[model samples]
Target: MTVSGAARGMLRTEVDRSLKTFLDHQRAVGGGPDVVPLFDAAEDFLAGGKRLRPAFCYWGWKAGGGGDDPAVFTAAASLELLQASALVHDDLMDNSDLRRGMPAAHRRFQALHEKEGWNGSAEQFGAGAAVLLGNLLLLWSSEMWRTCGLPAEALAAAQPAHDHMRTELMCGQYLDLLEQAHGENTFESALRVALYKSGRYSVERPLRLGLTLATRGAPPWTDALCSDYGTGVGIAFQLRDDVLGVFGDPSQTGKPAGDDLREGKRTMLIARTLAAAPPEAAAVVRRLLGDPALGAEGVATLRTIIQESGALAACEEMIKQYLHDALEALERAPITTEARTALADLAVAATTRDT
Candidate 1:
């Protein structure tokens, strides 16, 4: 395997181990047959991500000259829990049925309600349970970070960045919903959602958290790296994810084909397509974009419109440009040579990976 691939694999292993160990310990507080499902749902949701957020955090620490301490890994792995919280809420909001080929938390709960022949509305029960589960994961993420065994000084230094990240993510979620409600899929609005919801939360904040923890303080250059490099790479990563939601194979992505279309996601790709598509094609998009029953033919038709409109190519070019910008920023970052190389590799992988 390539060096980058090996590094990612090993990092994934360590992050998974840390998270599993934390969850296992938390089982006591949640020790009951009834609460088993919540923990099970958390585990299933966290099981299969690429661990990119934690990677960014880990590399950020390395950039600040931190060594391989298990405590750092423990702290970094908390990103997974935070990310899982976001995904659970996201799936619920989108009414998505699947995640990584498993029933979404809401759907899982829904099925459980039906199986037990509950008295009230199964759908409502499912939605409530999913919300509670998402909140629980969020709580656990903070707990994990606070208790990751890092020095008090280091933790205090990183706490603001950590708190701000979650707050930003939550506010971004609101912006997303607002955009959907207002039908505000303009390029600028979409970019705003991209920045707050995915970009900063995914890479920039995590990197800052790492750097602060490693140095026991946030260096001025850390802001430079987070802005120029982390934000650029993070936006590219979200853009790539937007493409995969439509064009990627369901087997690889764990979501159904054109799932984003069904959700009516106002992604930059969709925005670009609207800008570039012929009137007739744009009309077709408007007609079919959000129909819950969008079938294979609809997906194929939308795909063709996206391709013919040149939006797919446009988005791809944007990814390339953003990646270039991120690399240029990394070139200027005053970090170890090893960290620079790893961050560069992470930028590529974050933007290009299918899953």
Candidate 2:
């Protein structure tokens, strides 16, 4: 099988195993009846993601010469749990109604509130419940990590990196929120958000954590290779996401087309469009930026404007550049042939995924 195909298979198997473990844990604990809903919500949230983070961690470990230890699997699963926490909170923050073709966590809670005839505002109830559930997932992720049986020194080495990932993600989120509210965002600022938020957790830190655990001794140049690879691929992933947000089929994406436009995401593509559009067209783009009230027709027009402005081409070029850089970094790193091939495939798949 091809690398992409193999990665997909591995990802599916890991996700299934991890989810079973999660559910079994919940059952063993006999979570309070009131918190049954929370568990249900978490299960639903975990149902349909791509499981990219765990796959990265797994591949990173294998590349670092780690065997198929149960502890590695547990550590990888913890990354997915961390991802769940991030998504739950992100959906609430973005006020997204749908995720992976299902109602978002908050939306699910809102629907239950209405169905149960609860005497409270569904919006408030949903948001509050989702927040608590996200917190629960965060705690669960930490517990998973702690119980993974890694060496004490390895665990200690990873703590600061893990904490930094969370802090940087939160900061990036805040920057994103601030940019949305201000309506005046620069390409540099948007790129910073991408690096700090998605780059570290999505690629760099996870790879580092896995490699650190796998290699009993910390090797020089490991950090540099991870940084080079992570920054490149992480940005490429986000660029692809921006393209999908605007142009992807709603059925495949599991979200409304142009949702990013509606949310006024300060993506590199949008920044390029703003810079390249004709004066009149640029004005229209600026005016519509982050306007939640923009109807479908307006969105269509805006998309057209973006495409015609040459911004799409620019974004595509950037994606290619990042992919090249990632491959170069991989070449420079001293890793096993199988591991290098897997990472290369992942890089291609990440940039080219339709959903």
Candidate 3:
């Protein structure tokens, strides 16, 4: 099989096994009537995600010379739990209803509340349930890490990186919220959010965590190499996501067309479009950019304005530059040739993939 095929197979196997274990554990813990339903809802929400973070963690571990032991799988699985927690909170914050082609956690809970004729505000119940469930997932993630059979020294070394990842993500999320609320976003600010929110947590820290876990003491250059590689790939990944948010076919993406536009995401593409649009076009864009009530026709018009403003081309260029830098960094790293090649291929697949 091709490398991509092999990676997909590995990811599928790991995700399936991890999810089964997680579900079995949940079942064994059998909370009372109310909480049991909540657990079921959480499981349903977690079921359909792409498991991208865990796959990244797994491959990062392999690249850092870690074997495919059960401990490694558990460690990788922790990242997926973290991802689930983040998504649950993210959807609530975004007021989003759909995720991975199904009702979001909060939405599912709300529907269940209504279906069961519960005597409470379904919205309140849903949000509260989702928040508690998300916290549970976060706790579970930490526990998974604690139980992974790595040496204490390795765990100690990884703790700071892990903390930094979570801290940066929270900060980035807050920054994004602030920008959207105040209409204070700029291209630079968007780039900063992308780096901290998606870049570090999504790629950098995972690579660093895997490296720390694998080696008794990683060389000084190891962290630097991973940083360079991670930043490049992470930036490319977010940019591609931004593109897909607007231009991708909804069938494959499992999102409504122009969902990001509807949400008024302060993405790099939007910033660039605003910056480069003609004066008249800029006014129109600014007026309609984040309007949640925008219709499909309005979204089409905004897309046209962005395309005509040259922002799309600019974003594409930036993606290519990042991909080039990532390849260069990979070449310079002291990892095995096969590992480096695998990383390169994964990077390409990540950035160039349509879904």
Candidate 4:
């Protein structure tokens, strides 16, 4: 493997190990039978993710002159829990049925309720369980970060960025809900949602956290570099998700084709399509967008509209432009050559279909 590839592999392995250890500790602490299912759900949801956030944090630490240390890996791995927390809540908010080709947390609980012939509404039970599960993951993420055995001083330095990441993500989630409810989505509004909802937490703040941890007295220039490069990569990452929601392989993406259309995401990709499409085509999109029982025929029609309208190509170009900007920021970053290569690889992974 190349250096970057090896680093990613190591990150995947170490983060997985750290998460396993933490979850195991939780299990050993003992919970009631009712909560066992929640624990099981947490374990299932936490397993086998891409671990993208932690990788960015790890590479950020490397860039800041931090040495190889498993404690840093443990600390970085906490990001996986935070990410899982966000996704669980996001899936519930979107009413998504599946996650990674398995039933979503809410759906899983709904099934359990139905199986048990519970008295309350299965849907309500599922929704409530999902909310609690998401909260559980968030709590676990905080605990993991605190007990990662890092120096108190170092953790203290990174705490502000960590707090900002959590706070910004919640604000972003609120913005997403507001956008969906109002149903008046401009490209600019969609971009703001993307940046606040996914961008800062996914890449920017994680990088900032790592940088701060490594350089307790980090320079202003380093912070600027993290913002510029990380924001570009983060926004491009969400844009890639926009494309995947429409055109991705079900097996690869762990969701049905055109699920985003069914969910009425109102992504920038869709906004751009509407901007460039003919009046009739735009009307067709408006007519078909958000049908809960959207069929393959509907999906195909929307796909044709997106492609023929040049929205897909336009989104692709935007991703390229953002990636180009992110990489250019790297040119001015004062980091090791290896760190640069790893961060570049990560940026590409964030933007491309492959990861």
Compose the digit string of candidate 2's lDDT tens values, residues 188-248.
9878877776777787778877787787556876776688897799888888988998888
- How far residue 224's Cα lies from its native spot in candidate 3, in Å, is 2.3
Per-model TM-score versus the true fold: 0.97, 0.95, 0.94, 0.97
Better of 2 and 4 by TM-score: 4
Clashing pairs in 1: none
Question: What C-alpha lDDT, on a 0 to 100 scale, does residue 18 get in candidate 2?
Answer: 66
Which regions of candidate 2 are displaced past 4 Å? 1-8
Which candidate leads in lDDT?
Answer: 1
- Write the residue-wise lDDT of candidate 3 on 1-355 in tens digits: 2366776777768766876686677678767676787777667766776666676666677677877676777777788778888888888888877777788889888988899998979999899988988888888888877776766887887787777887888887788788788775688888887887777787777777777777646777677767788889988888888899888887887777888888888899989988898999988988887787888998999999999999999999999999999889888887777667777877887788777
lDDT of each: 0.91, 0.82, 0.80, 0.90
Off by over 4 Å in 4: 1-4
lDDT of 1 by residue, 1-355 (tens): 1246677778888899999899999887776988898888898888888888999999999999898888999999999999999999999999999999999999999999999998899999999999999999999999999999989999999999998999999999989888777754888898888889999999999999999999997678988999999999988988999999999999999999999998888899899898999999998998898899999999999999999999999999999999999999999999988899899888988999898
Q: Write the per-residue lDDT of candidate 4 for residues 134-243, one digit (tens) a residue.
A: 99999999999999988899999999899989999999999988876776689999999999999889999989888888997679867777878999999999999889
Which parts of model 3 are misplaced by more than 4 Å? 1-4
Pairwise lDDT winner, candidates 2 and 3 = 2
Q: lDDT at 234 for candidate 4?
A: 94
Question: Which residues of candidate 1, in runs, are more than 4 Å off?
Answer: 1-6
